[model samples]
Every structure is written in structure tokens, then in C-alpha cells.
Target: MSGDRLTAEVVFDTSVVEDPGDAVLAGVARVLAGAAPAWADRMVAWSPEPRERREIDALATLPDVVRGRTRWATQDRHTGNVELRGATAELNVVVSVNSSPLARVGGRLLLSNGITLTGLREQVAGEPRTDWMRAVFGEICAATRPVWGALYSASEYRAKVMADGPVLRALGRDFSRHLPGLFAGNYFGAPYVGLIGERVFERIGAPAARKAADGWFVDVLHDPFAWRDDDSVTRNADLLAELGPECFFRKGAAEGRVTRAPDW
Candidate 1:
């Protein structure tokens, strides 16, 4: 279910854009299409003005399009400043984009749901701010209501695991003692979350573990069995150096460095 894409209608407001050409809309559509389910289609505005309403028009004649002004509007306050109002579910998003002489594009995505996501691109500002534009669209795509049920279940699991913290740590130690090969190496490190609270002992004390997991290395580094030797402080320092200073560490934890193993 996590892999399944979301399905929804994507309606773009052409008025805020500098140009409402087909090419511009098509580029936006391309990125939006990637985040949407395979069945979703791009619905673009063919005309600048609203379509004429008919009393007896057939449903078949109507395009599968959202044909109304999103009630929200942006008022210019002063240079580099603007005011947004009427942002709600009934309104469409108000986007204001500015591409600069330095080839950087910065923009704000004001959603109908009263949420705003800002994007700034300095490294690579693609054609007509495409990179920033795609980021804005991705933010819009990700604006979903949280599933409280899932969150509650996850919280309960966390509580259960933490309630037996001591037992878990003992079990981890037993596993490490019986299977040194599974742990006691720089190849595997600890995770920031695992080192929180009393879990510092889980890494710095027994295993001499290094850094925390960051997505790709989550399983490898966070595995309880993947710890360093109790006396392998220098190895842990070397591992931290290899992992770079940017790796996440527990708050208030000493900065890692390449140093000799000191008697504990």
C-alpha cells in the first residue's frame, strides 16, 4: 500500500504564471504525472476566461476539467513581499515565482488548504525555473492529511519497545557476546534515534558504535548486532571519519574524531 501512488485531479492556475503556454503547462504536467497514479490525467485551462455556462448542456460535452477561479488572491504589499488571503479547500493555489539575474529562482506555493511551501534553487535553476517549479508541484503533491490511525499504532509500538528497554539492551549484549562477527566492526554503525535516552550505552559503551543511519544505511547501521568492540573507540572514530561529519548524532553527544583508544 505504501508503494501505491495517489490519484487526484491536478488543476493549474494559468493567471499567476508569467506565461500560460502549452510547453510550460506540459512540463508541469510531466512532473505531476510522476507523483500521481497511472490513471490520473492532466487537466489544463484552454482559455484564460471561464467557459460560458449553459442551462441545458449535455454532460458529455463538458471536458473533465475544473472550470472555476480558485478564490484565493495575492496582493502585492511592497518589494519582495506579498499578502495571501482566502486560502481554503474551496480555493486554488496562488503561486508567485521570480527568476533572478543570478540564474536562481525562488517561489512560494500557497495551497488551497492554507498550507504554504517555499522553494529556492541556486545550484541548478532549469529553464524558466523548472527545478523550482517541480519542487513546488511536489510539495503540492505531498500535502495530504496524516493518517492518525497509523500514527497511533506506531506510537504504541514505540512504547512497547521502550517499556522493555533494559531487557532489549541485555539481549543485544548477549547477542554481541555470542556473535562478535555480527558486530565489532566499522562496516556497521549505530543510528541517532537508537542512541537517544539510555540507548547511548547501546553504542558508545558496549559496542563503541559510530554514527546513525540515514535511509540507505538504516538496516545496516541500526541493527543491534552491528556494533563495534567494547574497546574499539579508535575504530569507531575512524568509522565516524569515514562516514563524514555530516552524519546525524545524538544531541549533546561529543563530536566524533579520529583518535587513539583511551582506557575506559
Candidate 2:
């Protein structure tokens, strides 16, 4: 979030889904069905390397051919897959603006991964993220209805991933992950932008919580990196704790944390 590139992610749990196909192609269909039921045909996926650039319209076919874990990346670089563990399967779908041509935006049912939840992140460069982006992300959060999710600066996210202990307890991703279910997944203290699913939203009652299509949205700054030293970070972190301290491991994680301000 140095004002040049901003990457944001949202993660949720898609384990034990509503449907898992019995055959390979059928499973693919099921996967597609949930890829982005809201956006429908707007979502698309492409095959991995060593394989030609094969684009698979996820919404066209998925989750119906095979009732097992799978992994696939889209043409836009978003990654999603149903992971298998012993006899259980979980979905991890990632949506991001970091990839080139950020057009595709759908996979699984939720985003991010820390442990029990899955994840999806977006990255955008050249400008401060717009409220429209945040709203769009909010819409995505509503669709996924994740237990909790966040939009953090890439640098801030990396920082928490490096310094925070229970961040896993807060958030999770599919590829490199742990089983953390704290709140807002990897949000060390409070996210620059945060979202709460229905269940928790009904409980926390944060005054600033805004009602979205399907979830509750919260934010501490206009743009994630807008201010590196604003006291609002601590105030926001305190508010999060005041609202739902048990939702996270370090309720005051964002306190005194200075991020790189955006140039815009």
C-alpha cells in the first residue's frame, strides 16, 4: 500500500459444501456453480502451466463431476480449490486485484485461509483503492458470507504474517496456511478494512458497522495506507476490542502500528 500497489484479500470456509459432484466433470460443474453465483458468466478460469492456456468458464461446469478436493487458477490469477484432509474437504478460493487484468472474481463460497476458513485477495496498482472497490469487495463478502474477512495493505498484511502470533487464529489462506479462526482472519489488531459475517455481525454490534447485502463492513481508514501514523488506528483497534475483544487474539494489534502511507 505504498500508493503504487494495493492488495486486499477476503477469506472464508467452504468445507463440506452443499454439493460435491460424483464424477470429474460433474465436480467441475459444481465448482463452477458456486464460483460466483451472483456474477454468473462473468467469472472465468484458465489452466495452469505445462498445460496450454486453457480457459474454463467455471460457472459453466464445476463441483458436479467429482466429490473431492481440487485446485485451479483462473486466467486473471485468482486461485481456488477444495482441499482434502483425510476424509474431509475444504474450499479455498482467492480473489485478488494483484493479478494482471483483474477481471475474473469468483471461486468457492468464501475467501482467505488461516485454518478453518478459506481466502480470496485482490490487488490493484496506480491509485488508491476506491470506495467502489471496497463496496465491490463488500459485495463479494456478502456473497461469500464468511465468518470474517479483511482488506489490508499488502505491506501490512505481510507484516502481520511475519510478526503476529495468533494471526492464524484470526485469518487463513489455502496455499500456505494454519487453522486459525480468530476474527477477520489474519488481522493482527484490526484490519484497514474489515468485514463480519451474519452470525458475528449480529453479536458484535459495532456502532460503525454498516449493513451490506449479506455481511457487516467496517474500516479504520479511507484507503488502507492513507495514514501510517493516525491515532485512528489505535482508536479503531480499541473499538474493535470494545465491540468484540474475544473475536481476536490481540485486540489491540493495530495500536501504535505505523504503515506506509500512500502517495495519492
Clashes of 1: 2
User: How many clashing pairs in candidate 2?
Assistant: 56
lDDT against true structure, model 1: 0.24
Candidate 2 local lDDT, 1-264, one digit each (tens):
333334334433333223133232333234324433433333333222232222234433333211112233434232333321111111233222121221223421123331121222232122223433454455445544444456555455544444456544332222112211222212221122232234454454455456555445656566555434557456556555544543333324465432221111
TM-score of each candidate?
Answer: 0.19, 0.46
Clashes of each: 2, 56
CA lDDT of every candidate:
0.24, 0.36
**Top candidate by lDDT:** 2
Off by over 4 Å in 2: 1-4, 16-53, 57-128, 164-207, 251-264
Give the C-alpha miss distance for residue 87 in model 2, angstroms.
37
